[model samples]
Target chain A: MATHGKKQDNRSPADWWLFVLGFVLFAAVGFWATPAILYAEKPQPFQFSHKLHMEQVGEGCQSCHAFREDGSYTGIPSLEKCKECHGEEPMGETPEEKVFSKDYVAKNKPIPWQVYSKQPPCVFFSHAAHVANAGLECASCHGDHGDTEKLRTYEYNRLTGYSRDIWGWSLIPLDGPPKRMKMDDCAKCHRDNGVRDACFVCHK
Target chain B: MSSSASEMRFGMVIDVDKCTGCGACSVACMSENNVGVLPDETDKIRSITWLRVYQIDNGQPYPNTQIAFFPRPCQHCAGSQGHHTPCVSVCPATATDRDPKTGIVSQIPTRCIGCRYCVAACPYHARYFNWYDVPWPEGMDKPLSPFVAPRMRGVVEKCTFCFHRYQRAQNKAFTSGEAMGEMDYQTACTEACPSGAITFGDLNNPEHKVHELKKSPYAFRLLERLHTDTAVYYVSAREWVRRQADNYLSGEKLAKVQAGGGH
Candidate 1:
């Protein structure tokens, strides 16, 4: 019994140091390095200032993001819509406009805008209900993405490879707008508005 | 054909006599729901079709034999009274559900854990498991219906009766200040049926066509003796077709007349 106890407790001070060091290293890697590796920043197709366009157009978000008579949301304006104003030449003298005209508009190619607010394949979010029926402003869930001067580098989760909008911006999600786009966020909003529904209500 | 109430039980009544064995309904359903078919889909069991046409025949020799096409969609079984649908009750993840209000069985692919318990529990063989990610051909994704999100691999999917169409109809009615009726909301399969074999409407509403059709003497459900209480009904004039609906005892008499006399 004594020999067994001795063998069991035979870890030295150096061994103890190594064990503690290994544990700390594992913890640090798990808490920080792993998350750092998992998230990546991707560039958008072109930077179009929503604030500038909103101010110039004076028609609100609907001018760009149209809602059809059938209550279907036409997401991300087509190049034809862009050509309405930028028909002859590029609208503005900015690099973005030059790229839009020379690379896309002049060539008659559609801008492949990387959708930031794109949910997962399973979620079914109806823009008509949130926009027309519920009367929510563009700033509600999207935060101030529309007002920014430049588009933020889209952060993607390497595991799911989904836009951060699906999981949220922070490593540790907190309570607030734009913190996360998980089901809980939707449920919270629905609960606040006294909307109770089954799981299939938003998921499909 | 008024605005649908919570008590509304939307169901389908397909006239087996009218179906011409054409696969229009299945094709339409696949495209409408973005149900992708694999390249090597020769294995009918592995292939996923929200609405599949099964060719069943009367087990007889030569000239006496006749085959009929049975278009099988998810029955959206009401089950006994209202709850305990075979698929719904056996689902470990609760991915599939029978909506208490509309009686439409809804399958949420996102919530599905791919356990496939619902697939096994379903007697109709309506549920299909996605063996691979949606194999959309080049540029085919562009034309995919924006309303229905394409499902990923490792999930189970089944018919939702085009519930999104109902949602759109409701939205249109709300916008136009009108009441959405049965005519405004129809499944893609129902609309695409060339023979008009499939009829869909609120079964609870007496004014609806399905309410009248389901009460026909010829109308019978598949495996009704087990009492799945499936919402989908089939009507046929043939006695053999009705006999083929469910199993019977060795000497059990199903109908008053024997099998060979139908015209």
Candidate 2:
């Protein structure tokens, strides 16, 4: 055993330290530098809590988010939709509601809400296929964001400019909520469900 | 996979005799699909035309002069029983496919790798390769149809039979709780034809107008001998016009081809 161990130590002590240093540098870059370079933090237009809205309205998401007759998904609620409720005054005494009513609804201006799950222009996503045809819930891909009381900062890739949700949130990929919205995720889900799709099924 | 009894086979039947060669079909297709206009359209071969009208003549002089216009769409070829269409089978990326349910050859621009294999493989030259970036004029982007996404450079695009309209029609039918039929969905070219020459419908459906129109004695498909099994059929009463549909050998008489009753 001693002879075998000595034979294995064919390199100098300095060589061992250099190898250790290289590994440490690689791990630091991968664990730290990669995430910093890959993601960009941006603030949302306003603090909108879905949980609070759900509690107040006592309705599902489709009430605020409508699917058009043409099968197009009205992703973000239009300002006109907000005007329906906050026509005269703010829904709540909160600062966000006050700002929304005064700056947007009352002034007849549109609120530029930053969309977190926006896909690239090339990708053609059909909300009807997932929600109407497949009978999938909004939470399947979006996680419990609808139940979260506070608005989280939108994280996007610096290079591809895609949402962090597209690449999955965790760098280590521990397999949690907010599953990546990449094509691989779609393919895997389709495979699991045995839903055969042509290339034009989701693409145009 | 087992085919459903309600499977639709969408096809077009164009009456060449009624066509005035106005190029309305081509114009409508381009505008509807948001097909980019090239900076230099002088090079006809390089230019993109989802639905092109080719003028063919009998090569007669003066009084005997005869000319006919052929508006060629993608054809959505359903080659023989087992094989896929020529373009679809040759596509390395599987970007183009014939949807068995609808018999519509669908081209996915996003999945296209721009290899141009399918473009070359196409006999009708239906597929067009995007050589350069689409130069959208000032304020043109805003007017683009939301249903059809503008194709990026380095991809191939062909006639999609206005699939978005089908999706919309399907959605409308679903909402109304009504069954969608051939009349529910029609291509832009078919709708824009001033002469009402083009008849589009589910060829498989016995009740559809196209089913009756396709069986007309005057109907003939382009290059039928190649056995492309094109969905689009042309109808012309003129014997010379029928002869122009496909090639004939020196010994093969026109009477013999007519007896065969369109391949």
Candidate 3:
């Protein structure tokens, strides 16, 4: 019985290290969790009226970002893609139509169109990889932009090419199932979702 | 393509004794890979070549002068059981990979955003960057091999060991429902060399001629001590030509290796 007590007391140093690691993980969750929870889940930039665009005009996401033959996707509609359809002033009624024809089409520049969900460069955020592989909704990462009624005005960090809000905070829960689009955020999702990768597999 | 580790150290062995300095292999590699040509390709570094023949000469004047041409390409290291390969270790993007199946180092050009770290990591300088976009004179894009896409400007390119051929061969096997056979793949340079200097086959297969040639007494890898585990081996009777491929420090361990090991 005395020997059994001694054996019970003699836990391996590995056990101690694992305990320390668990405590560290808990602390990290606590520290990071607070900021993410508190941030305002502000409405998206530009009042992008998706119902007006998708429902009334009968356009799809592909109407903007053209699909490639090889299953890759390309840029949102360039000024030319818009000009191809919208004429030099005909059947225009709403303020939105005026903004599209007069401001964007009249000027030869592609709409300094702010891409709402611009994932950073170091990561390969293949919409194909996720959509085809995991069966995830677009709203899973990009918040409910499709439901909104106005153009989402883009907020920028500029230097990092990250959204100003994403650089700091989001109402998205960091502790729950992966909600954000950081590399580690995606890595966590991959781990939970049974997708695996090396650092180079996604980093570059 | 994969087999047990003992039977799967994929490699290449080059016979320098049989080689002539004709640039046939280089020309074939460029055309086969669809490597873009700049109007100013006179500069070699900025130029793309999957197989490049380098001229090496015994630095003696007149009658004593001896010249041999050596071709440089990716070594495709076996990588120390599971450790560092010069290019494979440092790649920030998983653009390059040593296939465990065949031991071929595969390059994914689309994944490579011209980070040139792999270019600099290779001791042989095999990888090339597309500085200028591929400009096919009007109405010539259809002639391109449907298997290989011509690379755009700003991507790193290299010898795929003619992986498109391997893929086609694999596809044929898949449709026929037969296993991929030994003679299934041969790099364009190997077939194009007039002198038959380059031999391409899976080193892992004992029945393959490449496997037997690998055991020759004359066979040696480039920079073996740097531990790159280079697949390419050169067999040269000329000591100067063999020595020119890699640098040896003054009275270094390789001097001892040559004295004691009899390689």
Candidate 4:
């Protein structure tokens, strides 16, 4: 009975540190594997520098991403808008511009640029309400995309087909838009702004 | 300027007398909402119809027979003062909600868990559960409206009063820095009615035709005694047609109670 009590008292101090180390190792693997398995990256049609375009344009983002006469946001400028500046020749000496001029411009095919912040088909996001009516800056929701030198790799969730940026880069989302674009972020903004956060407002 | 919940109450005043039961409203609603047409549409139980027309008749013999059509969409029930809309309250997943801004009940099919609690809770039988995925025939999907997402199977769906049109109108108004006009947003059924039986607009706006139409002596909502406080109002000049709007005890007369009208 005394030997048994001693054995119970000196059981290698329960190896509590080893248990914590095991937990940390598993958590590290989870953090690394979650993003790797869930997301698939695809390159944009061609790397385009928004910084260079921003320097050339007068009205900032609106110069290219303008709203239609009927108030609908023209998401990506069509080939016609690009044609207005660059005729049949390459505007810049960059290899990306040369490829754009030869493949998209010369061929008259629309560049299939993958949108990074594309919401699901169920969402009805109104740029008119947010930008025109509320007078919100473009940088409020979309980070420094307009001032970036090159387009970043577009990563999308395999299961939901949503952009990885929608869930944000971190496993645990601790920030709002410009980092995360979840429904909670939208609702938080709406709640803060005294706007109606009805389901039909955003969900058609 | 954006309208608030108290400022706008979008409702419909449908004139039952003028309706010819042509089913044009139903067809337009189906097409506008992208409601799926099953292969065997004759199977009424399986069909998904956002707006359904019901034929009611005065219980009279052949010579005295009179028939009228009631184009029934979702009542968009405002419920009572507490806003306990039957479907909205019973929706466990909050898949359905009555939008305070417009008094329009919205059903988010994606959020719906297919519990069918809302379907059962709705007194109007307006909600329908999609049993099958819509099989769009060759090239038929090309014309599908991009505004409203087509609902998948296992989700309860009902009439939205063509909310997408309202969104578009609001977008136009926001861009132009003006208020949404009375005619800016009209449901497809309202526009498609051959006899102009359906009138839709902000019931709160005096300038809108629906506001005046809803105040007519003949205006009565279906199952009014239930106190659903529905947005849709019906008008019929015929006494028997008005009587059919709600159930009454044998001795109770609609005319006697209607005299104390308070809708």
| Top-TM-score candidate index | 4
- Residue by residue across A1-204, what tens digits does model 3's lDDT show? 355646756788999999999999999998887555543333432234666667645556556655444434464666677676677583457765776667666766566656646655434445544554345676677666666777544555534556543444444556322234555666767898765643333432
Q: Score the docking of each candidate (DockQ).
A: 0.31, 0.40, 0.03, 0.70
Clashing pairs in 4: none
Better of 1 and 3 by DockQ: 1
The weakest ten consecutive residues by lDDT in model 1 chain A span A168-177
lDDT per model, in order? Answer: 0.82, 0.82, 0.65, 0.88
lDDT of 2 by residue, B74-179 (tens): 9989997566699999988888888878889998888889999998888899999998899998998987887788998999999988888877776655444566
Best candidate according to lDDT: 4
Tens-digit per-residue lDDT, A26-85, candidate 4:
999988998899999988989999999999989999999988878899999999999989
Better of 1 and 3 by TM-score: 1
Q: Which ten residues in a row have the lowest lDDT in candidate 1 chain B?
A: B254-263
Total backbone clashes of candidate 2, pairs 3 or more residues apart or in separate chains: 0
Q: Each model's TM-score?
A: 0.85, 0.90, 0.55, 0.94
Question: Which pairs of residues have clashing backbones in candidate 1?
Answer: none
lDDT of 4 by residue, B1-263 (tens): 54433557898999999999999999999889888788889998778888999999998999999999999999998888665999988888888888877889999999999999888888789999998888989999988988999998888899999999998898899899887888989999999999999999988878989888888888888988888998898998898999998888898978765622336
Output DockQ, candidate 1.
Answer: 0.31
Give the TM-score, chain B only, in order for the candidates: 0.93, 0.95, 0.89, 0.95
Worst 10 residues of 2 chain B by lDDT: B254-263
